[model samples]
Target chain A: MPYLPTAQSFLEQSRLLISARPTTTRITTKYTLPKTSPPDPSKSKSPPPPSSEPSQPHQPQPPKATLTLKTYDPISGTCLKYETDKAAEVGRLIAALGSCGRVMAALPAKEEAVDEGAMEVDAPVKEDAEGKAKAVPKEKELKGGQGQGQHKGGEKGGGGGGGGKKKKGKK
Target chain B: MATGHLSTDEFLIRLATLFESRRSVNHGSVFLTQKRLSPHDLPKAATDTPLPPSSPFPDLHPPHPLPILIRATNGKSKDKRKDKIKLSTVIQADELEGFFMRYADVCKAGMSGLKKRDRSGRKAKGKAKKKKGASGGGVEGEKKG
Candidate 1:
């Protein structure tokens, strides 16, 4: 049973108690934190700033060459370039020479020719006994040479004989 | 049950009926038919049951000659036989020797290619070390003096 103050007296006593404590001023200043303002809601709607610089463009690399088959045809003396796909064709040509034995014999001769200052460019042209370069005759040239003097004479004689007989018959 | 004794006549009639039923039931099955053979009706003189004459138990035949047997009997060693005989030996020694030499060359080429790759790798490493030394010249200079 201590004295209970009236509401008006309680208010006056609270004011007196608060003012009388000088230590409370430092405590209030220390504990009373500054209010944290709400995060700026306006920032959310704005787009992020673009990167300062552009990226580098990509450069394309060139394709590389791969080596395949190497062949030397003695007849042509040509160092022909046969890719991987043409290997079968090369095999077929080799087989067509009856046996590999003949091809082996011819290859050394061509190699020797190449060694003797023959240009290693196109197919090696075979040289005659006189050491002169021999040319490869075309198919038409071969046929013409084969038919030569005899064929033309025979045709002329046959035609002339037939015409003479026709003229005689008409007369 | 009463004492059941059939008279001889009744017994004979029952036996006949039993046989008749047995015959009717065994129509298609010969294995089921009962054979009637009296002891008195057996064959008179017992025929000689010929003992199956054994085959002249295959007169100890000589062993068949084999290729290996011929080779053995001929007294030639395997290596000598292989060297001595010339069966359709299509391939010549010169050609085969040449092929073997070429194959050895090819193997050498492959080994050389690998060695070249290793040497090139070492060269690259050496170049990289040289480049690093050149690039770190300032550090080397700082350490030296």
Candidate 2:
């Protein structure tokens, strides 16, 4: 059986999560639906193991992929499980739910920086500086002069270190 | 849960209508996650393959993809008390690929529609040509010519 999520149900959702792996891809949506009956036991608790276990009763079974759509409403407390292997059905549900909002990739910031570093080891982050230099050539010259002045001030501060070194030597 | 599936056209229409209705509210977010397989967790056959002889860092270019686990939370400041819903279903790679492609198109359509609506709203507000610099000068210059 295929799970047909309604437009109203889609609007009622607070969060939607789609996990895509090489072998298995899962689409899960959490709805803050209005509570009707006493919450279903399966809603708060983990899914029953029996539901998953009964599917594979035979031995020497080959690796066969199955699409399972599990809808759990927190209010109703009823967890509906639908299983299908049809590509068309799975694609349709994904397309429908996916359109509700934008799909932002869950990539970590640190790993992306590391990946960029590994790929472009020699490339320096000078694009912004170069672009500013090109657009405002006068500003670049002013900045260079300011940098030189700061360097000269630092050199004078280094000369003052001699008096401090003499006091340390006396101590 | 509805038992019967909707046609592709009807499904898109319903989604668009829902989106239009929910545009004003802070209805929360939806995102996609993709996991990359790490070399260590890969199958023995994939690990057995040799790297290219010309490369310096052979370890960097592993034949097997890296295993990356991506966790998606609601927002930057996650609520500790609220129960985060976790649900996942397993499907084949080919079907998943098709979904991603279609999802991209859907997002593009949704974004373009929103942009069009925003432009119309701005026009209604009479905020056109609020600029006072080069753009304004250019308009005056063209009129004089």
Candidate 3:
């Protein structure tokens, strides 16, 4: 009798197994991508005058170089110009290279840091009389990177680490 | 949107930079898209918005990112026609801010080193290596995404 067990007990065991079945849950997503680009939500609202930039239908072109890093030869009358495509990269490049050399205007503008680049142009700016150089930073950073956030102190300790160890070439 | 403003490579670079900062949490919080900017809100400065006849300038340094906008294309025709395609670049303002903040110090350090390079041509090469960094550690983290 014990080996066979009761029919009621068997039914209860069967019910427990059936109830233990794993359930599949489906995740619901709200965002549905449209067939085409989503319309600008702010289009209906009127705003200031739009840029006169040519809007002839075409692929959006890659951005152009805004900052020009020009290195002037002190002895010679020649200069090497480096036109960086990104203002941010130029900033990073200058930071990586250390000492904007003579091209302090190349510093990422809008930062509160003491810009030696702007300082070097101080005389010329003063001479301009129009005080144009003072506006140079803002003019350069027209892409709206607000330099006001957190102040990273002493970025790079104000100097490139000591000179690289020159590899002694064998004759 | 596929404005194709910041390419995958560029995004990866930013991602690498943000990770290097050890601020991954902040990085994840960035939304890939922003409420579409008005065409008029586009930057107005010449340097800021130097749209030209063509954009095939060969530059010395690698091309970095620009402030992405939901711009209208005027010449979307291979047959020499113009039509602005409305697409959004995968760049968010906060992400850009975070990237700049993370690399700001690193970039400054790089700039600081250029002074030494100006002194000696041979040493300049070494300084360049140093600026590239990880040379001292025997392994410089590749400056890529």
Candidate 4:
């Protein structure tokens, strides 16, 4: 099995989000969610991998809420929900969220983003501001010179493709 | 201008390499289950071995602790002895970011507490510097008089 991205990477990339909101155990940096998501619980729960190594001991199954990390295709309407509890595996998804260039979606989050049954909304979802207005804050934040060097790296990771752009186009 | 997009496959590859270079904090308990033996779990075989299967797995918050169950699927095998069948250690996930995030408050509290102490030390230093400045001013006044 491929080893997970080191604890340091996740620690570095998403440290702000994690430290900024200590109570939040799970956070989704959705590049884009459709305007009328109508979130489905069944679809969200990732299918466990086949029981190949039943003899292996101490293979704990991930609990429901802290378990899923999905990326939905706006065009095909497919959701790629990851299932492994491996720090390396799930950590990749978590790190991806930090690295992803999350532009504001045209639509705001609904009361029911996903039927994550016991998944508590750890913090209030930020209200979607007008398109251009949202840009102002990001630009000002860029001016503050916080991790501006990483911005170049963002181009290589996320800025190259427009996952959010595609999702927004469909909505 | 910041512009790029992440395809899922691409992101996975980048996570393996780019993110690996940075330094991470030690949460201490992560190494406990990291190199654990998943195979050779049969109790008959295990009891003969020295190390007992990992007994104490860490508890999780937003709590996603997967149970470590060692299934005994032998037909007509009704062995009730606890030593005959060993259960798995109760831990989950390959990556530990979630684990760290779960205990972030503890780490944050420690970091902020250190910053506060550092600030107090700086204030004390500033006070000493001011005292020296006052003595210099007194020497200058004597010369003027």
- Choose the strongest candidate by DockQ: 3
Q: Sorted on DockQ, highest at the top, how do the candidates line up?
A: 3, 2, 4, 1
For model 1, the TM-score of its B chain against the native B chain is 0.22
Q: Which candidate do you rate higher for DockQ, 1 or 2?
A: 2
For chain B alone, what TM-score does every candidate structure achieve against the true structure? 0.22, 0.33, 0.21, 0.30
Q: Tell me the fnat of candidate 2.
A: 0.02
Give a tens-digit lDDT track for model 2, residues B1-145.
0223344344445544443432333243323333333444345786686445575634333443233222222222366426332212222222333444554454343322121223577775544433433466667778999
Candidate 2: residue A154 Cα off by (Å): 58
lDDT of each: 0.27, 0.36, 0.30, 0.30
Model 1 ranges off by over 4 Å: A1-171, B1-96, B104-120, B135-137
Error of 3 at B130 (Å): 28
Output the better candidate (2/4) by TM-score. Answer: 2
| lDDT at residue B84 of model 3 (Cα atoms) | 25
Off by over 4 Å in 3: A1-111, A116-171, B1-98, B101-145
Per-residue CA lDDT of candidate 3, range B1-145, in tens?
Answer: 3234555345445534432332222111111222223223444652465444353522111133223221112123576444223323333333444443443443333222122222477788877975665453434223431
DockQ comparisons of all candidates to the true complex = 0.00, 0.02, 0.03, 0.01
Candidate 1 per-residue lDDT over residues A52-111, each given as its tens digit: 212422223211111122222232332222222211222222221111221221211122
What is the TM-score of candidate 4? 0.20
Top TM-score model: 2
Which candidate achieves the best lDDT against the true structure?
2
What is candidate 4's lDDT per residue for A1-171, written digit by digit as tens? 122254333323233332222221232321111222223646757654447445554335212111233333233333233333333234334323322212111012222223122222211122221122354445534443444456557876684466456445543
Give the clashing residue pairs of candidate 2, or none.
Answer: A40-A77, B37-B65, B37-B66, B37-B67, B38-B66, B38-B67
